[model samples]
Every structure is written in structure tokens, then in C-alpha cells.
Target: MSVPDTQVVVVGGGQAGLAAGYYLRRQGLDFVILDAQATPGGAWQHTWNSLHLFSPAAYSALPGRLMPPQVGEEYPDAEHVVSYLRDYEKRYDLPIERPVRVAGVHRDGELLRVQTDSGTWRAQAVISATGTWWRPFLPAVPGRAAFGGEQLHTVEYRNPGDFAGRRVIVVGGGNSGAQIAADLAYDTELTWATQRPPRFLADDIDGRALFDAATARRRALDAGRTDTGGVASLGDIVAVPPVREARDAGLLKASPMFVRLDRDGVVWADGTRAPADVVIWCTGFRPTLSHLAPLGLRGPRGHIPTADTRALAEPRLHLLGYGDWTGPASATLIGVGRPARDAAREIAGLLRA
Candidate 1:
């Protein structure tokens, strides 16, 4: 349980962290990857059992590691992805310290202090491969605590059987909400909450037309272009099952967000009453940055700011695994690795100096 001081410490162990670790290994830098989970894979392991990659298998591999699934194969399920992460770690012999939650990161002279649950670690450079999609977000409704109803986030949902033979109002109009509602439509009356009509990407318009362009932009961490808060403009990303299937059903209907939570059901912003026995908040997630105490977080009501342009701030601080496009790939498992590779070079130079 003793925390040793390392030259470079990578926080987070998903695609981004692993990619950075790969680069560090090539550069022969001394570092350790600290993951909060008891396992290697990040959020992918927590995804619904049936969730699959939207990207073609050819496009999903990290810098050096190859995803075992064949190119253009149907999106591999979460099980495959999780297994592959373990394989990736084993193949590289990555120095990953699991279940070591970074509690705080602050300046300590020339090195960075990384405090975890068991002990404290130090490093001259800290690569926060901690991605943007960290904490799940569900809106707080009035009387939610008092409401006597089945409440759960979409993450906790396995399938429609969770609400079998019951009325379910799904909150949020993005990918998860649409799919969950559609799946439950046969047995349950479903309603979807939305700020406005959900902008769904049609099959023909969503995806990377060329790998070269996608690779370049990905390496850049293209976060500045996305709007403050909203779903990815799912214009083109390959025909994921969510869009096609949801569209096939009439369940894609999105109503105004619920104004309040009643003991019996949800009351809409337009003063409409909808009866519901279960409420699934498909509201999405927020980036986890509690471990980052030193980097003053951005925004009062919007998403993470991509405006910090300092590439060499404090000669040690670094942000990794941020978005590349104003696209779903940024949020998807397939998108994080390239940015991590680019970030590693920048970090190495800072340490070498």
C-alpha cells in the first residue's frame, strides 16, 4: 500500500490512459496508470450488457493494440470490449494500479501530488487521461425524493424487463433514452422527455468518410467546436442500431421535459399529466474531475470548456482523452486513443526539459 513517486503518472485506465501508457513505454518513461475501478476497462464495462460499438472494427483499435474483432464486423458488445482491455493490459504489461482513486491533484514544487484512497503518489507530470464522461447526470425534479415511484438512471437499466408490464416514462431524448423506450414499447406505455425534438442522425449521413481526416482531427482533441450542452449532431457515424430501430417504432416521439415528479407519474412542462409506474432518467453523464483540485474547473452551467490553450502550463500539468470532433466519436470508446498518443509526446517534452 505504499505509494511510490513516479516520473509520470497517468490517471485513468481506459483507451486514453492505455494509449498514453503505450507511448510512455515506447519512450521509456517511468510512469504508472492509476485507475479507480478494480478493473482495467473504464466505463465500457459499466455500459448496458447489450451495448456495442458504433464504429466499424477497423476504426476502433488503439495506436498499437488491435481490437480482435474483424473490420466492419457488427459492433462488438461490451463483453468483447472489456475482455479486450484486459488483454491489452496483459499484452503490454502496463503498470496499472487499480482501485487507486485519485483524491486530489495539486502543485508540490516541481512535481505533482496525487492523493488516492490508500496513499499518496508524486510525479513530475500528471496525464489526466480521465475522460469527460465521468459522472452520470440525472436532473433533479421537485418532489423526486418524496415521490413513491421506481427511479433509476439509464445506466442501471438492463432492458425493458426491468419495467415489464408497467408504464415507463423515459427522461432524455438521446441515444440511450430512445433505445430503452423503444425496447419497452411492446409491453409498456412509454414517454420520452426532451428540451426540444430530438435530432436524430439518419443512416446515410453519419460517419467518417475518410480515415485520414478523422485521424488528424482526432489527434487534435477537437473540443472547441461542440455546443455547450446537447446531443452529438449524429449526422454521420455509421448506422448504429439505436437510430434505425428507434425510428422504426413510433417511440421516437419526444415531449417537453417533465416539470415535476408526482407520486403517481410525471407532470410535463406544458401542464400535461402522464401516468407512469417507473421513471428512467436517461439523462447522460458529467465529466469526473473531483480528483483534479488544482485545475480550476470551467463553466457555471455548460459543458467542460476547451478554451484553455496553454500547451505547457506550469511545466507539468496536462489534460488527456478530451474530444476530437463535435461528433459522437469523442464520447465513444473508439475516439479517445488518438488524442492520448498526441498528448503523450507533449507531456514527454515537458518532462525532458
Candidate 2:
């Protein structure tokens, strides 16, 4: 039995990973963060250029540092977020090794062996926070493969100008779909299709409201009360400036989901056809947990069941920033702090014991 390289090895450097690092450092733990990206900012760097936070800059902050507000922008865009994350890392002086993708995590006696592209690291505790950005999910609709025009996922979409002069269909009713559609509404011929009517949050609802609701729900559950059904009960889309403007201008109307795709367009169940040269699927993403396959903890839905943030089957392992399963709104920049702090404190206590 040899000494482990560190007490903990965080498997990402994105918002979630950075949040974990802040708490881990405060705990005075020996840890290292492994980020696949060569640079910082995590998934924010990869999002579409026009992407903006759902909340104001003042509310979309990490645990220790507040993100600087973007000048003249209520909702800071992707570039602002990337800049903030890069500076946050420098301010915190976190130990992060970039471009070192983790291959897998395996059990080694009492330690967890993390195999990465750079080298293998052994740790007493492992925080898997790779997130879902890398795993863009495209629904398997019939005849999708036969579509002649370009079909792209939310991950691949950049801006509306890219699809100019083309008949485009933006699929999904989520925030991504709404924002992207707004971006293309005036630039090109656009059709927004969703499984159901899109639901928009109240004008006042923002990331702060959502975070507060999530916190209340968490507190209710902890107190053994009936689930308050926090943010989940709210509408799906947060009417950000772009989305709101488009909606108010009657440019963001949603059509029922098309039945199938033809070479040139989509067909509704009613046999009405809408021609399209491009289909942008803003469906959603799955957690990036291929590295955890060796642990055999993922359930049928490709999620690892956990109590709080710690894996039930493997107490030494914790999953953060994936979503509510790890912790309520743990995927958000402002929402991840509580869970990250709790996980770090637990890991420190266990190692100390």
C-alpha cells in the first residue's frame, strides 16, 4: 500500500469543478483539478458566441468570487462568462492541470485510481464534475438520418448568421432553443418546433429566483416536509432579453413538433410539410461520465444515484454539477456553491477520520 498522490482529484475545471476547488482549498485538502480543456472557463468557452447567463451577473457568481457585471448588459453573454472564469482561476490560484482528459476511474484498495491522458493519479476521494457539455444529446427521431440538409445540435450552433438564407428549424422548448431561435428569427427564415407549447417564466423570474426556489426546496426536503417543488414547477424558459424581445415581437412562436424529417423538410402528423434546409436540435445534454464507467455506478438513465453529492455505492466518489440529482441546481454557477462546500467538508471529514 503506497501513499495516494492527493486526498482528492477533481475531474473537471468548469464552473462545477472550480466551485469544488474553492471549498477543497478552504478545507486545506491536498487536491488537483483535471480539466480536459486546454484553457479555463469550462463549458462557457464552448457555448455559442451569443449565449448569455439566465440571471444577472451579480447573481451568477461562484462561491468565493463575484463575477463582474458586463457593462450595459443585464444578462452577461458567453464571452463575459469565459473571461470571468479565467480570472477566477487566477484569483483563486487553484491547482488545475488542463488538457489532461481522464480516461477512467477505478478502485484501488482504499484509493481511487484516476487514469488520465497525462498520467494516473490516486486519491482518497474523487469529485467527478466533468458536466454534460461534451455529451450533447440528439434525439433519435425516425428518418432523422435521412434528412438531406444539415442537422446540428445545440453544441455545434454558433450564431444565426451561419444559417442565413436558409430555411431553419430550431427544435426543443428549452432556453437554448428559445435564444437560438431569437438569434435567427430576423436573420433567416426560422421555424421553432417543440414537443409542447413553450412555457416562459414570469418577467421577474431570473437565475436568482430559480436559485432561491431550489434552496427552499432543499430546505423543505431536509426538514422532512413535503417537497415544495421549487424551480421545477416554474416555466422552462427564462425570458431573457433576446427571448423576451422576440416573443413580444411575435417572432418566437413555436410549432408543434414535426413527425419526421424529409430530405428537404419536416412533416407534421397532419401531413402539413414545412421545408427546411437546416435542423438545429436544442434538445439537451447528458452528463459527461464516460470516465466513471469503470466504477459501474451509473443507473439505467446514465445517472449515478447519490445521497446528496456522494455516490451511494461508493462513498469515496462524489458527482457534482451534473444537475439536481447531485444537488439542487448544482449545474449553475451560483447554485453549485452549497453542494460543493458540503461535498468538500464531507470528504475532508472522512479523510481526517
Candidate 3:
């Protein structure tokens, strides 16, 4: 079919996508953003009802808005983040086509052909902003079928209220695991297990985000040409001292081990059998790139091969909202502006070229 032409087509409506769209608008590019969700907030709306962002509100705003300090005094819940994103869309007059899933993307000579559930769009350039959260990694576990318990990944989790009377086994030990375990143990039997001890850091030390420490290590790795080296898992990111704090507060019981899963429940590395009514895996996410799989990815892992300086692998194709989306500055809304601006310049070049 002959597709409608556009200067640019942005995939994914998450923060990165929005930022790219806003920049695209500033550059006067004729573009439309395609998002799978009905609204603009992306997956943040699907987060647990009680979920509050760990980053302060000030750090959460997009390029055009400013979240207040008052909002940051405490964590902003899922709803607040959604409201802010909606406001961003309104301010920019962004042309985001909702619930439009990108079915396929390919190079049709010079133009990128984007076929969505809604229709097809041919763009001179395309921004694959489908943030990294599209896929959830659930490694194959032996005897998983045997453990007839309630199994769920963190994405499906709403809150701990439903877990009031159940023995919940929260595994993987990421922030979700820690927070969920802390809340659930308040009213039910809980065990927070990790394959290895995670690097636990203070949420804020004198107003500094703990994630900065991990970022520093990552920067060093990148500097040493080890961007794809054996990076630490969730447990490795959790430091020892704060982990003790979790144990001392009775928020979690240290079960530094992994066991087999079966109909009976989980069996720990130390040979302890814990009968769990629910198993919540707090394991992290996989970059959702299913639609882009046929695009001839140039990276070793599933990621598109992006040069150290560029966020796109080929002409008319770019990516934003990656793991190191913008570096230590990633922790602040301030960091988003520069990258968005850079993306805007690149999109402008495409429009002009």
C-alpha cells in the first residue's frame, strides 16, 4: 500500500519518545508519534497504583515543564507522573497517534516504511523511541511449572494489600523487590531472596541519588571500552549497609541464595524449602524491540548498534531512552534537555537532507 509521507515518525510514547517529539517540533519537522498505549504516559500509567517515583519530582519533568520542589519532598506516585506527561503533550501540541502499534519498519530504498496497526506512514527519518521497557526478562527456570503457586512479574504487581495473608516470595532484589518485600512483610510472611547480595545504597545521601554511584562505575567501564562487559545484576547494585538496614527494619529477611522451583514452591541454595503462596519476580526489564527485530540489528545483544556518539545505527533511524540515556545527569530532568536537543538537530538534518 502507498503510505502517507512524513518528515519523521517516532515509535514509543515514553519519556524518551516525548522528549524526542518535543525537540522535533522545535525543529519544525513534520512528524507523528506512534504509541501502542491509549494515552501519552506510556508504561508509567500501568505501574502499581501505590508506586511512587524514587527520583525527586524536580528530576522527572520533560523539556518544557518544571515539576515543583513541593512535589519532590516525597515521592510522586504513578498518577502524578501521568498528569505531568499529559501536560507536556498539551504544551508541545505533539502529534501522537495513540494505540498505534508499529507493526513493521524497513528501509524502502531511502524512506523508512512504518506499518502500524492504525495505518502505514512513510517517513524520511524515524525515531525508535520505544523505550527499553517493552520486554520483561524471565529466564527459563527448571520445574517452574511444578510450583503451582501464583506467579507474577513485578510489572503485574499492584500492591501488597492482596498479599496480606499469603506467604509471598519476592525474588530478584531490585528496588521493586526491596520495596514490595518491605510492604508485604508488614502484613504477611515474606522472604526477599537474591542470587547474590545486591548493592544497596541510601535513597538519598545529602540530596544525592544512590544510583549515581552505579553510574560512575558504568562510566568507568565505558571509558575502558567495556560497555558490554559483565555488568552487575540487580543484587550487585544493592550495597551491604543499606541491605542491613532492610533486615534491621524487618522489611526483609536476608535469603542470599537461589533454589529450585516446583509445585512445592522455591528451594533455596542453602537447602531451605519455603512454601510460598505467591512468587513475585523483581527481575529487571528487557528492551522491548520485537517490532524492530527484523530491522537487521547491528549490536551483539539485541540492541541496535549505536556508536558511542550517536543514538542511531542508520540514517532515518535513531534511539533514545537507553540504559545510559544521558549519563549521571540521567537522574535529573535537566539531563533530558540536551539529549532531546541533540536529537532535534539530527532530525532537522534529516528533514533538510
Per-model RMSD to reference? 4.0, 1.6, 3.7
> Residue-wise lDDT of candidate 3 within 136-176, one digit each (tens)?
77757776788888999888888778888898888886766
- lDDT tens digits, residue span 161-250, model 1: 767788888887666776676677777877877766776666644234333345444444445553422224332223467646766665
What does candidate 3 score on TM? 0.86
**lDDT top scorer:** 2
Instruction: Judge candidate 2 at residue 22 and give its lDDT.
Output: 96
Clashes of each: 8, 0, 12
Query: In order, what lDDT does every prediction score?
Result: 0.69, 0.93, 0.70
Clashing pairs in 2: none
Better of 1 and 2 by lDDT: 2
Model 3: lDDT of residue 268:
66
**Which runs in model 3 stand beyond 4 Å of their true positions?**
1-3, 69-73, 206-248, 308-313, 325-335
Candidate 1 similarity to native, TM-score: 0.84
